[model samples]
Target: MEYAIALVVLAAVVLVIVVRPLLGSAGEADRTAELRAELEAAKEAKYREIRDAELDFRTGKLSQEDFRRTDRELRTQAIEILRRLDELD
Candidate 1:
């Protein structure tokens, strides 16, 4: 009976060792997914800002120089976000 109990305890330990990583990976996957979603949202928001900036320029709300600078900055940010998203894949 003592031997049986020891065997059962060993099995439980082994099972935990194996299953713990699987559980941790599930959490990692969730975090990765959340990060991806956040990145995508940021990318879209950047695009919208670019569009809005263009509109403002056309409507004369922003000076040409201001628009160009804003456009360059927004594009750079969008590129970085895209790069991060690609890295996730």
Candidate 2:
């Protein structure tokens, strides 16, 4: 009886160990998807900011030097975000 009990316990433990990675990966996949969505949203927001800045420049609201600096900074930030997303992939 004791041997049977031990064997059952061992089997349970083995099952748990085997299944843990599968379960963990499901959660990991969800997190990765969420991260990708967030990254895309950020990209869209950055693009909108650039477009608005361009509109302001065209309307003569922003000085040429200021527009250039702002546009460069926005592009740099977008590039960094893409680099990070690449690393995650």
Candidate 3:
């Protein structure tokens, strides 16, 4: 009976050791997925800002020089967001 109890305890320990990493990895995957989604949303928002800036330029709401500067800055930000998204992949 003592040997049986020891065997059961050993089995439980081995099971936990094997399963712990799988559970940890599942959490990691969820976090990565959440991060990817946030990055994608940011990318889309940046794209929308670029489009709005262009519309303002076309409508003469923005001066040529100011529009150019805004466009460059927006593009640079968009590129960085893209780079981060790529790293996640």
Candidates' C-alpha lDDT = 0.99, 0.93, 0.98
lDDT of 2 by residue, 1-89 (tens): 99999999999999999999999999999999999989988988988999999999999999999999999999998898888789788
The residue-by-residue lDDT of candidate 3 on 1-89, one tens digit each, is 99999999999999999999999999999999999999999999999999999999999999999999999999999999999999998
Winning model by TM-score? 1
Error of 2 at 67 (Å): 0.3
Candidate 3 to native Cα RMSD, angstroms: 1.2
Error of 2 at 30 (Å): 1.3
On the 0 to 100 scale, the lDDT of residue 2 in model 1 is 100
* Candidate 1 weakest lDDT stretch, 10 residues: 40-49
Question: For each candidate, C-alpha RMSD in Å?
Answer: 0.9, 1.1, 1.2
The best-first sequence of candidates by TM-score reads 1, 2, 3
**Model 1 misplaced stretches (Cα beyond 4 Å):** none
| TM per candidate | 0.94, 0.91, 0.90
Comparing candidate 1 with candidate 2, which one achieves the higher TM-score? 1
State the TM-score for model 2: 0.91
